[model samples]
Target: MTKSKTFWAASALISLALMVFAGYSIYGRVALHFSGDTIEVKPVPLPAAEEQEEEKVDTKSALEKIKAAEKEDKEEEAKAGRGTPAKTEVPRMRAVKTAFEYKDSAAKSVLISGSFTSWKDKKMTKKDGVWKTDIYILPGTYPYHYTVDGKKKLAPGKPKAPTGDSLVTVN
Candidate 1:
């Protein structure tokens, strides 16, 4: 074969090998991601017939007590010269402590961004091969994702948001 032809063939083979290596690397990372996680299921016991009947009775009594309490409140308001209580402002929701975690041993840096953070990246701390961050958030549903080494990745096993991010409900 001509030297030029040999050089071209060698280049093509090298390119093919590089592509395969890249593909395998990606596959291994993905496999590690899925395989390292675990899920636990605990069986729940059904209530006894007597317990179910008692629960129904208790629920009815509780509802009746609530109605009586509301009636007393309205009567007190009327006596206080407020015929109907003025519309009270809704109480602000308290922020709840929420934890976010991700596992990626190869990542140099991990960050989290979401509606809670106004889409700003928040750096996560790494410990024992896991990345973790705790943020206080108001009770509601929010969409979020991780940025590992500057690349976006969804939370594993989480429901996808409309914008293709992971969904987290804080309460």
Candidate 2:
């Protein structure tokens, strides 16, 4: 009878120990999951109005200095030129009527792009299955191509340069 009582008591104590260990593990896991076991707080300072004003003053002074330096450089250039207008005159640009034609009847849209147009999409109009557009090009060599339905096509009878674009000379 004594041996049986001791065995029952030992089993109850072991079971209680395992239950306590499992409860502690669950509590630790939940605490770490919710708040990561620590709280971090930081304080941020607000900017002062006087500090901002000082920064503005510094910026203004720097701009004034730059303006003064530019004025001095212009005066020096004027003195070197001996009281005459700056050399070299800008060439007068003229509007030249240019035309392009795409003979493909299957094309849905056509565009003319060149250096004057900044290589942007300039949509052309279709007339009797021919795509045409008039561009006012300056007197220079421009590399251009045609975009027919989102496909790049070089101008007909114009060979592509090493830069992979057909050249056009406006005089």
Give me the displacement of residue 21 in model 1, in angstroms: 36
Best by lDDT: 1
TM-score of each: 0.54, 0.46
List pairs with backbone clashes in candidate 2.
none
Candidate 1 residue runs with Cα over 4 Å from true position: 1-64, 73-92
Worst 10 contiguous positions by lDDT, candidate 1: 35-44
RMSD to true structure for each model, in Å: 11.7, 25.4
With candidate 2 superimposed using the best TM-score fit, by how many Å does residue 29's alpha carbon deviate from the native?
A: 58
Write model 2 residue lDDT over 41-143, tens digit each, in one string: 2223577699898999999999899879877877887888856545446578886777767788889888887656766789999889898888887666667
The window of 10 residues in a row where model 2 has the poorest summed lDDT is 35-44
Q: Per-residue CA lDDT of candidate 1, range 1-98, in tens?
A: 69999999999999999999999988875564355332122234576799889999999999899879878888898998886665647688899999
lDDT of 1: 0.83
lDDT (CA) for every model shown? 0.83, 0.75
